[model samples]
Target: MNIEPTILDAVNKWLTPAFDAKTQEEVNELMTTAPKELEDSFYKDLEFGTGGMRGVMGVGDNRINKYTLGKNTQGLSNYLHEVFPNQEIKVVIAYDCRHNSDTLAKIVADVFSANGIKVYLFSELRPTPELSFALKHLKCQCGIVLTASHNPPEYNGYKVYWQDGGQIVPPEDAAIINAIEKLNYDQIKFAAQDNLIEYINTEIDNAFIKSSIENASFNTPQSAKDELEIVFTSLHGTSIKSIPAVLETAGYKNVHIVPEQAEPNGDFPTVKSPNPEEPEALTMALALAEKTNADIVVGTDPDCDRLGVAVRNNDGKMILLNGNQTMVLMTSFLLKEWKKAGKLNGKQFVGSTIVSTPMIMELASSYGVECKVGLTGFKWIAKMIKDFPELEFIGGGEESFGFMVGDAVRDKDAVAATLLICEVAAQAKAKGSSVYQELQQLYVENGFYKEYLVSLTKKGMEGLQEINQMMVDLRENPMKEINGQRVIMVEDYQSSTALNLLTQEVSDLTFPKSNVLIYYTEDGSKICARPSGTEPKIKFYISVNAAIENVSEITEAEAFLDQKIASIISEMQLK
Candidate 1:
């Protein structure tokens, strides 16, 4: 294999004495046996995206390894020092059930300790949200979590969070990236300062559980909680203890666990992918739910930051609800409960992503609450919470099965979401209704909205180019129509501009610049295109809605919307 000079230089750097012996041996083996793999791994440094870095675990510059994590921690340490020069810097660290996650978490803590930063490291694996909560609870300047949320087994990630209990965003993200890029392998401090590292566990768990219960409690009837049968699966990750604990503490008595997936296993042997958004991942839990005649089936991703649920429909058949459906349920339920409890003042608000269904905004409007739209990730939602400290952040969610209740933890949290979702189910049951029935009622109250997401995975160097070309083509030649409907407006997030086709007037977008495009149709259809920041894929989110005068018409409306989405996909040649 003919290696490029740049790739060879990177490969040679790993072979030097600065790297460990095992990493050196792995690199040598790859050079001799798998030159293509070596090239792919050494071609470039692992990019630190807005939420930090995620990549395949291996022994190369582009891979997530001890060295890469070390360098990132050191850079973060430097930035913390620069920002808070006189104060004694402190950071909390957590890991999930991913391969080498525990080891990597230790390495991260070591590097931070070496930089003279006090480290509060979890004694065992925990959910990602707990890390965010610990950061703020402990009053630490920053925090880190080592787990690639729902990625494949071979992948792992490092996420950095600010004191605000949200993932790093904007100026801080750029600054951290710059600091990471300036460091060399030799500059990373690998030695640990044991005295500065403190192991913490039970104390934080108690506080987090207390906070979750307090935030989610809406005086849910105890009889309803007792009658609700909940089947929960952690998907072989960190939510094993916390999710069940929160439910039980909230007075839920009939909760069952999927035994096969209850334990933390990095391989995620039970599912193809640990992502709860995928239907297949919830198969085991669904089966268990059927056996137990459970009222609802819930599953969380590997990091416990996202949640997916399946509820029994009117036909007594279990059906999985998509991200939008769950968000609608949670948002609408929270708003209603708050109003019922006399908590809905003009100062309360909620948030969702641009790709999420517009029904949330309508629901918020009906309740006289403000609904803010962010770019995509939950970090943007958290940023909105931070930006508007005067207003009460009721709750927020994205179309990725991620929802956060209240402000206990700024990031998307499955623990609180799972508990609150069960509460919603309980109350519905008490009212002689089911979760699915309540969802249909929601559609009847606030026009039916159906959302679908299609992701095209583009792997390796060539695939990256193809993805970029696709975006360029869309931007250069905007579509005038889709599914025979005229494109009334086009919003280019990268350019921070929105164009109204009829009036040909352009308006500036206030959100941060991102590589995303949204097309609005004259018939109330919306399409969003954006590349995943954390994965090797481009995603298209389609949402179509119609007024539902009767709850019985939901099926017909859903079918019509599905066909509309299909036609749009076909017209755009996305198939």
Candidate 2:
């Protein structure tokens, strides 16, 4: 067997006395029997991306193991101390249903406590958004949640949040990375200071649920609540308790849970993958909904952050709505309800990502509200809320089935989103319509916008080089046209510049620098290309739109837009 010198050095470090016996044994076995796997595992130290550090669970510097997590927590602890030097530092920690999530949460709490920082740790598994809410509700300086979001069972992650309850962004993220690099494996403080740790559960759950209910806009009649049949599946994740509790508390009587997927299990035994974005993940829920004649079917990812929904179409057949459709429906509903309540005082705004549909901008504009477009993550949207303190943030979402309601929770919250979606359906019912019909009505008022996302996964070290090269090639050779449509403008987020191809004018962009490129066509079409920050994948977001005068034109408009997207993909030769 052959191995790189650097890889061999990393392997030897793991075999030393600093590592646990179990980890050392695994390393020894891998070196003797599985050199390739060992090399991949130890080739590089895991770096924190926009969603924090995440990797496959294994025994190596690159994996999400005890040593790596300990080092990250220690680094965060040190950074928090430096940032809040004169105050008593406190942090909140929560875990999901992933393997060793609870164990990692304890280790993190221990490390924080060992550093003389107060730790508020959940007694059991909880949704990711609750961690964000707890961070603000408890007035903590920093927070950590052990989750890989919607990743596969073999993966786990660590996410760091600031006091604003959003994932760490900008200078703070870079500074924390610098601090982490300066620490060695042996330098991690894992010892426990029992006195500094506090276990919380019911109080936080009650508070979160109360806040969610209070923030919901209830325009549906009592009959809508009584007649709405909802089928919810948590996909064996942490929302098993909170989601149902909220629905029942909100007076929804016909809510049914997919018994097979209700329990919180990290293995995610029922579905091929726990991610609701994949149609297969919702297969069981859809079947149950059909059997029960349900009006709406909702499923959440493992951490309960992203939501996927299914509704009966005009044909009365159950069909899953894409993330963009869900976002459009939710945003339109919230904006209209706000206006009806006379809350549209021009001091309110909504947010969306560059990859999201532009229809949200039109919807907000119709209500005299501002729509802000940020980079791809919910953290960026949360930052928008903090940056514009004068404006009331109504709600916002992305193309990835993640939505944030109100300003209580800074991250994309599936729990609150689920409740609000149900409310939308009920309100639609009260108007002698369905959620699907409401979506069509939205299109009739605002032009029809269709969005599609294609992700190409490139794995391992060699794959990383391929992904980087793809981005470089796209940036160096800008596309003048796509699918016979003239590209009017090209926005390079990395360079923070927008170039008008027709006028040959280059202007600076106000948003932060990121490795993303967006092309706008003379026709109403947008194409964005970006590499995933948390995974080894590159994603292309294509949005094309046309005017819809009535509901009859939806099918034709969608088909036309679909063909346009296909032509663009073919021209780019993306496979």
Candidate 3:
């Protein structure tokens, strides 16, 4: 195999004395025996996206390695010093169960401490949300969590959180990127100042668990909590550290953990992938639920920021609730509780992404709470809270199996979300209803909405080209209709414009510029095509809804939506 000139240039640069012997040896090995691998690794640098930097672990600027992460930390350090000049800059760090996360986290800590910054490092693996809370709880300027979320086992990542307990946004993201781009591998500081670095564990954990309970607990009666039998699986990830304890403190006692997948293993041996969004990832949890006749089943990704839930339907079979379904259920319950407490006076709101179900609007409108739609990242939702401090952020979530109960932990938090769902389930069970029944009633009152997501992964340099071409093709040749429905509107986020296909009218969209395209049908169907910013995949989201007369017509409503989606998918040739 022949390596390209650009790859060879990056390869030769890595062979310098600035790189350690171990890294140099691995690079030489790839050069001689694995040319293709070498090309893949050095083709380009790993860039941060909406969720931050995530990629396979290896020895390249393009991969998640000590050098790349160190560069990021060093750049962050410089940026912090610039932004918070002459102040004592402090930061916190945490890691998940991914391979070498602890080591990578320590490397980052060393970089910060060497730059005369105070560092608070977690002594053990912890969920991602705790890092966000810890940064704020400790009054630090920034935080970092080493995790790849729910990607494959070979993947690891670094996510940065700002002072607001949210991921960096806008000018910050751009400035940090500029700092990192200006530096070379030799400029990163690797020395650790023991006096400046402090190891932390229980202090942050206790505070986070307490805060989670305080935000998520709705005062479900103790009797209801005991009656709500639950099964949970961490998918061999990090949630096992906090979720059970949070549930216990929230008055939930009948919780069962899937023992086989309870241990924090980086390999994620029990499942093909650690993502809870896939039903197969929750197979063991479902089995345990069936064995124990559990009322509800819940699971989380490796980082524990997103959760998947299953509940017994009216027919007595446990069915997994998609992200949109859970979003609607959780938001509705929160709104209802707020109304009962007289917290809703047009001074509160909920959040959803453009790709999420429009039923959120219907649900929020009925309660007189505004629903804010943004780009497809929890970070954007977090931005909403910071941008609108005068109004209360009751709750918010995207269709990607992530939700945040409050702004305490600005990003997606599964630990708190799990507890919130348990409260919902227990409250429903006490009222002679279940999650399934509640959802049916919601459909009967509101409209019946179903959502589907298709993610097509494109790996390596060639694959990136293919994915880019796909988006370009869609934009250059816009679609006028799908499933025999007239296209009423087209919202292109990149252009920041909404084109009304019917009247040829155009209006401006007040959203961040991103490569996303959405088509609105005359019948209220929403079809969105977006390229994922974190992973190398293009996602197509389909949302279709129909009004239901009553709960008895739910089956027919679902069938009609299903047929509509299938026809839409077929017409688009997505499959």
TM-score of each model, paired residue for residue:
0.99, 0.98, 0.99
Off by over 4 Å in 2: none
Roughly what TM-score does model 3 have, to 2 decimal places? 0.99
Q: Write the per-residue lDDT of candidate 3 for residues 1-575, one digit (tens) a residue.
A: 87888889999999999899999999999999988889889999999987999999999988999999999999999999999999999999999999999999999999999999999999999999999999899999999999999989889999999999999999799999999999999999998998999999997899999999999989798999999999999999889999999998888889999999999999999999999899999999999999999999999999999999999999999999999999999999999999999889999989999999899999999998899988989989999999999999999999999999988999999999999999999999999999999999999888999999988889888989999998898888888878888989999999999999989999999987999999999998999999888898989999999998899999888999999999988898887
TM-score of 2: 0.98
The Cα local distance difference test for each model comes to 0.92, 0.92, 0.93
Query: In the order shown, what is each candidate's alpha-carbon RMSD?
Result: 1.0, 1.2, 0.8
Q: What is candidate 3's CA lDDT for residue 104?
A: 99
* Runs in model 3 lying further than 4 Å from the true structure: none
Query: 396-497 in candidate 2: lDDT tens per residue?
Result: 999999999999999999999999999999888777899999999899998999888889999998998999999898888989888998999999999999
Best candidate according to lDDT? 3
Which scores greater on lDDT, model 2 or model 3? 3
Instruction: Report the lDDT tens digits of candidate 1 across residue range 1-575.
Output: 79999999999999999998999999999999999999889887888664568999999988999999998988899899999999989999999999899999999999999999999999999999999999999999999999899899999999999999999999899898899889998899988999999999999999999999998888888988888999999999999969889988889989899999988998999899999999999999999998999999999998999999999999999999998999999999999888988987799899999999999999999999999999888899999999999999999998899999999899999999998899889999998999999999999999999888999999887878899999999899999988899999999999999999999999999999999999999999999999888788999999999998998898898899889989988888886
